[model samples]
Target: MPGKPPLLFDEAFLRKLERLSLVARRARSGYFRGERRSTRRGQSVEFADYRNYVRGDDLRALDWNIYARLERPFIKLFEEEVDQTVHILFDASASMDWPPHPAEHHKWNYARRLAAALGYIALANHDRLTVAALSGDAFTPWGPERRRRSIHRLLAFLSDLPAAGQTRLVPALTRYAGQTKRPGLLFLLSDLLTPEDLRPGLSTLQYRGHEIALLHLLSPDEVTPSLAGDLQLQDVETAARQDITINATVKTLYRQKFDAWQGEIEGFCRQRGIHYTLLTTDRPFETLVLHFLRQRGFVR
Candidate 1:
């Protein structure tokens, strides 16, 4: 019999993740009670403010001390604690399976590990998390589950996902925004190789009240190509071919265009108040999570 597959995350790494939790810069409304503090005022131990007592108000909420001093009834209000809905959108398109050799650092593998780590953090903090893999026209999803017990299911779901088909970001995102009723935090992990204008999809999510964070993943090979001589490059997803000579001028132009493309995406994100981070698969997983993500304010 074959040996069992290795776990996506070791116990030591999971324990480290337990120390962190997803951060939402602004308050969000959730259906279930949890650790996150919300803007909505409700019954909780932490005091919010006091308001003049109105008819039919709960007598138990009346501030006896204020009543004695002012001879007027006042109701004590408390800050509401609620769960956050965290959505992780993973891109499993063909381009993400690049650099066929060295499977460990493949874009697909790196992205899956990152998703698993983030989902675990949310689970540890009792936040509702939904993970979806987007490819072609399909959106495969798992969980709106919370708590550490759900980590196993999350890992299994992520491990089984395969990268294939073209990435159709707009339709997939638009459909998700329409289907998901509650608005919260949304993290999109993708290489963003699609030619479609992403503004429509991103704007839709924002309109639905989601706090969006775009993790633009790329491989080191893609970022800095070392190819020389004549080359026939084919699009991984579309299979279109292009023949070009790999000369000094060509390489210089390629680098300039690549940088411009990245700048365009960054500018768009900044204008829309969306958090954007560019990541290369060559980076260590621990550094990406423990250091980079923390610096980005995604976790604390």
Candidate 2:
């Protein structure tokens, strides 16, 4: 697929796009200005309730008219509310730097475009956004503020992310789960080719009350290994290689294994009520964002 326009991450797109909101099917009751019904109601202009204001409260909301007649300094404070935070966890690993062959696209490039488009969409809609690269050690994951003004910060954070090293999804995810105190939407984008099982990692985040959404990016070659005869398949990240003669039976077995792996992942996500979608690098990112994702309710 052709690469996305660099302007996809521009501020103009965000300003025009913020009107569109993703209707989260699962209950996510934090805050947002959108008219969508929330599971938890709080202090918004929509009017939830009123309580006595404490010290250091905004005095403008004080019921001056009430005080003039009733002789009481009753202040009206709007309920605490805002948009839900959209936490985007992108995988920047060496495996994602896999080269494109023939009609296939680069994995990292595809991921980057998707990340940028999604971030823009979220920011445009007045939703809070946190874009992080969880491929490093338990260090700080940086990104723009949830507001629309932080467009440059979000772009820089994504552009500077390096695609290198082996991925330890469990450690990275567990660390994020520990640090994040608020419950919100979480999207994990990765090829998921780590040596370790990814289930434990995903489960950790899910247990933290996050609406887990997994975007599995796979290359055409990885899904269907077209190698035949004597060949050496080298691990792109580890630099390890295994030499084997590819016969029809071997090819069949590999296909079975690949299918089984995909099935296992799909089953795991379904069982946990997590949203899972697979995207091949060869497909257009716009199609994924505007069509496939909308069908999945990530956009509307």
User: Which lDDT tens digits does candidate 1 get at residues 100-219?
Assistant: 643556788788888987887666545678999997756888988865688988887987777887979999998889999877888899999889988999999999988898999999
Candidate 1 local distance difference test against the native: 0.76
Best by TM-score: 1
Once all C-alphas are superposed, what RMSD does model 2 give against the true structure? 8.8
Residue-wise C-alpha lDDT for candidate 2, range 43-127, written one tens digit per residue: 3454322234445555866788877987766555322333457788888778887773323377876676677667766664445
Each prediction's whole-model lDDT (CA): 0.76, 0.67
Give the per-residue Cα lDDT of candidate 1 at 10: 64
Angstrom error of the Cα, residue 59, model 2: value is 26
